[model samples]
Target: MYIIFIGTGWFSYVFSLVNLDIYFSKNHWDRYTNFAELSLHILCAIGIYIGRFLRFNSWSLVTQPKHFLSILPGELIGKFPLVVIVLTIAIIAGLYALCKPLVAKSSLYRE
Candidate 1:
């Protein structure tokens, strides 16, 4: 279930990025759009850590938001969580770079 959920997140994140490139940047990514995309990747990486290790789900964000937010800084303070987030960010950004062209090139279907 968690895998499925994360897959959804990845798909949504990718489409959001493509849309940003298309609409926000007028088909070309600007510095601000790139910044926003990278920031979101970092946030999602942190979210993955929180959900996996801390066992907080989407409901926790609504029901126990204060607790959730409170734990994050302390939890992410150490080297381990920092390493996880950084590595996750690298994976996400790296794959996105590799896949963006494939996504854009999917116009291979017959007209």
Candidate 2:
């Protein structure tokens, strides 16, 4: 877990900036990208909750597809999953909002 979610999340933002630099120009800073990012983060939080609590890693989907899918529905629709996913998204978003300006001002960032 420590190795997986080590950073406070500046790393992911920086990686996205690099991806934009590669695909589009460095000047491409779309506001809608934030919405897309938030949506992705929410989904990822749900997945993380599933993986952590249910012990269903990525390989479980491929190796044990039937069991994984069968159990997924039950695991997903409940108060625990909802609370965990929401809290994870909230923390990451809050940290992003608090630290983004600092990230943007760093030498690693570009206009």
Per-residue CA lDDT of model 2 for 12-99, tens digit only, reads 7646644543444335756556766687678778878978999889899899999999999998898988899899989867876676
> Which prediction has the highest TM-score against the true structure?
1
Q: Model 2 clash pairs?
A: none
Q: What TM-score does candidate 2 get on C-alpha atoms?
A: 0.73
Residue range with the least summed lDDT across 10 consecutive positions in model 1: 102-111
RMSD of each: 3.6, 3.7
User: What TM-score would each prediction reach against the true structure?
Assistant: 0.79, 0.73
- lDDT per residue for candidate 1 within 6-80, as digits (tens), equals 877766667667777676666464768878889888988988899998889989979988998898789888989
Q: Model 1, residue 61: displacement in angstroms? A: 2.2
**Top candidate by lDDT:** 1
